[model samples]
Target chain A: MSETVIKFGILGCAEIARKVGRAIGLAPNATIVAVGSRSAEKAAKYAADNGFPPATRAYGSYDAVLDDPEVDAVYVPLPTSLHAKWAVLAAQKKKHLLLEKPVAVNAAEFDKIVEACVANGVQFMDGTMWMHHPRTAKMKEFVSDERAFGKITAMHTCFTFAADPDFLENDIRVKPDLDGLGALGDAGWYCIRSILWANDYELPKTVTALRGPVLNKAGVILSCGASLYWEEGKVATFHCSFVSHLTMDITAVGTKGTLHVHDFVIPFQESEASFSVASESGFDELVTGWVPKPAEHLVNTSLPQEVLMVKEFSSLVGAIKAKGSQPEMKWPIISKKTQLVIDAVKLSIERGFEPVEVVG
Target chain B: MSETVIKFGILGCAEIARKVGRAIGLAPNATIVAVGSRSAEKAAKYAADNGFPPATRAYGSYDAVLDDPEVDAVYVPLPTSLHAKWAVLAAQKKKHLLLEKPVAVNAAEFDKIVEACVANGVQFMDGTMWMHHPRTAKMKEFVSDERAFGKITAMHTCFTFAADPDFLENDIRVKPDLDGLGALGDAGWYCIRSILWANDYELPKTVTALRGPVLNKAGVILSCGASLYWEEGKVATFHCSFVSHLTMDITAVGTKGTLHVHDFVIPFQESEASFSVASESGFDELVTGWVPKPAEHLVNTSLPQEVLMVKEFSSLVGAIKAKGSQPEMKWPIISKKTQLVIDAVKLSIERGFEPVEVVG
Candidate 1:
């Protein structure tokens, strides 16, 4: 407990947990103290396979990790259906929470997790790694510049990956009782989060689900899109799917400038990410081509974005434990807004693709 | 009539006409034989300013230009409201029509223009300049490669330009009786056309207007967006506006590949255009970044796309005039499909953003 490093315990040996486990090790202020799975052998294998330190404990059950007084925080990479249950339990046990996205199946469930965090004075943040990328910050600076970008008019984001047939049928994401929201929860989360980030986290006024959403036999969304409208005429649209090639893009157009990025969910390179921006773009005198073409900006990062996400989350936890500071409210608030939009989109789709008012 | 070159008489001295006039001059098989405006002095000025040949005729009335028996074709850059009238008249005069888009305010009107072209045995093509770009052909080769791209799943296109106050207040595009459809016709035309082009000219089954379209005082849409859905589950969305920074993009995602172009309407340079494509994109072993990032392909062209459009149109006209061949039906068919989608989107907006079935 006297160690300066934030000791982390991950609940469930999900595939994503391995990545986060590495992130915990890479993050300067964090360390993996333990990992838990339903089977002790799976936990041991996951730790051994993912380069967890020899000192890391392999727990037979998630509760064993929660009960470990040495574990300062828990990374919850369990299925969406298990998020509220385990995240709240971890929070009650005084473990700071790093919950995987689609933080919960719905906003109400996320609210329960948030309430637990508040009651137990635990720091909470979702596993939206891209937000911590240095390139994201640089892009935000350009878009927020009044002289350069002016008022935002519209934004569009998309994230899609062609999932293998076996994955589509057997993955927990498609199971109604597991990651019930399917691609909308897994892939759409990034698209929606990017839009909200471009809008400076302002909630949209309404959400309308685009037609022709592909659904699995279990009635889970395989692919879908939605348009979001703000009261001030700023509009955004996003599409996400498990049936298309890997493509992640964010196109935000303001009155004076436009921002374009092809890889927003993950960088094309671990050390660097790039985006293009054009300010006051116009055609040449002859109307043949662009007068001032967009210029690409590359941001270099020493640590991968996921590791940065872990560092940021652990730093907040450190502040709470060391200085008795109140838990950071920003991450949970943003997570709740994203969950709200996701729920609104789902409702709009359920209502025969009608426009659903987004209630903040 | 004995000359091999296609003689083009341009209708009106609009700004776009000057560009097309230069395009006509650039096309090896097309010559600007005449230009007509409401004022003879304006026609003379336009012809002189645009470097038309000394022998080029200047007419005070459009009818005078159409009456010239030597004029084999006419490039109609008049406002949308005048398209059906002038285009049909040009066709009836046995002049091949290179009409500015949105060819007409509606498909029914464009049908009249096409019917006249059919009756008069003259070629018909809308002035969608980018369609003839060599880069477009190259991009098509990649998108159509089944091994590389697989089945088309979704596409999104956007075209927007920040309009000055004068333009918003007084431009012909904002006048209901002039362009009528406003930004939807002026800018959205290219977006819808790009979507149709990506789908290989297959008409969408339905069109749903996205919420939050901005319209001028006269009820002309200044900014708008719509989502088009095909019966086979392919979906496309597009946004066009006169109030955003200049941005023309096409992001087409297939089951196995993705294509991205930033300046699709107009290239960044007159001599070359580039697009990015990724086939079977995957993540690196650690899932940190793309394993093989999208590669950029550049295509060089001696003539700008507008000039290519003129060349293609005149080539069709030349074949008909010299070899006694039938006019190409492909141009009109594609133009009609584009107009049909536009009309459906307009209808959807009028119906309170309901999904309107597109009947081609």
Candidate 2:
């Protein structure tokens, strides 16, 4: 019956951890209880630099943070290669897990993490922040409206960022021993998530990587794309790269309407985001111009999407910890589906751009 | 030399011809001198309903319009099946040709039309009106700016319209013996043209149709998509459909910039059009949102794009008529390249979604 505040432990000093740390500070039900790094001095510096509260603990290793009794949840911002190891450990420690994506290098590894969470009765969620944005719900409303959006026919999503020379050469994402999956695991994670999100979380029947994928000498993808086909004629394609300009776009066309968002992965503004939609649009009598032009809809939120994500995860964790409620299954299910598609795309690429059946 | 007005004779009273007739009237140096249909009554009715000038002649047959001495140029709005026959005949009659696109059923037929125009020393331009939009030139300026846009990387275009039940069953676009190519020739033409336009009219090395193209029982494409690959790592994908909501979008990304236009085929407004451009876009600290957000650039025009197309065509025709200037080859060249890609996509679809080498 008492008010519960979820205590979150930071499980690495990765760059993304700084953002998640800020998000923890912003979430009303969440508090940063601990910070950890391989070196105690680095952990202390990260806590100080990210503005951890005075009472927050700094640990010399991820094991120390997971071993903290007061840490109700752990946000794992470690690289993709470390996700399975740390995520399973945190779940075994009975801490609700907020893991970063690509949740693992492949769905098989991710299933182990999911199993650990289920066995421990701990909540699990991936760090796909945009899924928590208010604008996403609003856009989903439009796409689900039968009279407005009708049945979706096709969708295309692209997420690309031009990495600086230093990042391209030395970033963890490009290193096989670190992130391992490279751009496909990083940027393509978001792209596949988006395609699945647009299709109401329905997994496609097959995924075929497009030809001309650029891979580094270490067998890490630098740029790639894939087309996913579903039964009933629904199709989706996505492109993700670390070598193109920063561009995030989603164009979903349905029988009656279309939804277009230019900045989908990261919004143009922190407080508000906009998407354009047109329903039953047609040209004028002379076909010179559209009769009913598409209209832009804006959704505003007081907190950044990352903060909203932390708040949502913490709330789920709080329910399970304080009231013995069952952990939410939707988040992990979505994460597993996203990983499945990513793995299918990688397999398609490895097989010379052939179609790979997506088995659930 | 006296100023010469290029007099246009419309071959066939197709619905699209009404729009072109209006554009011909709007172009300052162009006049609708004749309109012809299979029946003289239909021709007269089309001219009257479409607001042709009182002095415009109505002919019972297309040959009569071509035979008129005052008709310096002809706008061929006939079906695809008849384009080669009518376009070549108009060229042989010493008339400059403004041909409707899918310029022919395939490149072979289109090339024959081109040869006839060359032999007759006639100006040739396809009725791809968007190419003449003032906004298009503005967009080109952004994409071509080395400092602002950087080198092109990838592009995606979509043009779709949900046909009403009546149109789905009876429209000329879906008829096998009429337009034949259906949505690909109609909507896909714009998508291919936009991709080619973004790439500075450079033809791709190969074209591969995406899987699951929806075809009508009549063997006409109802929906389709294709990916084009250039040897220089530039890639493009486009989708066109008659079973989806009306949406025309182009997203072109470069090394340092991105360009997006939602209504590319037909601007939402006749007087002004806008596109969004993001040059050297990046994220702010903490990576919460975009810094230097994409800017919207608007271009205004007194004439609609179609009228501008007519005016540009007439200017070329007038130059040849009044000053004995040679016909410009750029327009025909671009049209041929677009047709070549379309042919390749069709072939790829026929070959069960294999990559088709695009031989220019």
> In candidate 2, which residue ranges exceed 4 Å CA deviation?
none
- For candidate 1, lDDT tens digit of each residue in A249-302? 999999999999999998898899899999998987778878688999999999
Model 1 TM-score, 2 decimals: 0.99
Best-fitting candidate, scored by lDDT = 1
Which stretches of model 1 miss by more than 4 angstroms?
A: A1-3, B1-3
TM-score of chain A of each: 0.98, 0.99
The number of clashing residue pairs in model 1 is: 0
TM-score of chain B of each: 0.98, 0.98
Task: Give the alpha carbon lDDT tens digit for every residue of B1-360 in model 2.
Answer: 445778999998888998999999988889998998999899999899999999889999999999999899999989899999999999999999999998999999999999999999999999999999999999999999989889988889999999998988999899999999999999999999999998999889889888878888899999999888896457888889999999999999999999999999899989999999999989999998888899999899999999999999999998898789999999999999999999999999999888899888
> Per-residue alpha-carbon lDDT of model 2 for A90-178, expressed as tens digits?
99999899999899989999999999999999999999999999999999999999999999999999998999999989999999988
Model 2 TM-score, all chains together: 0.99
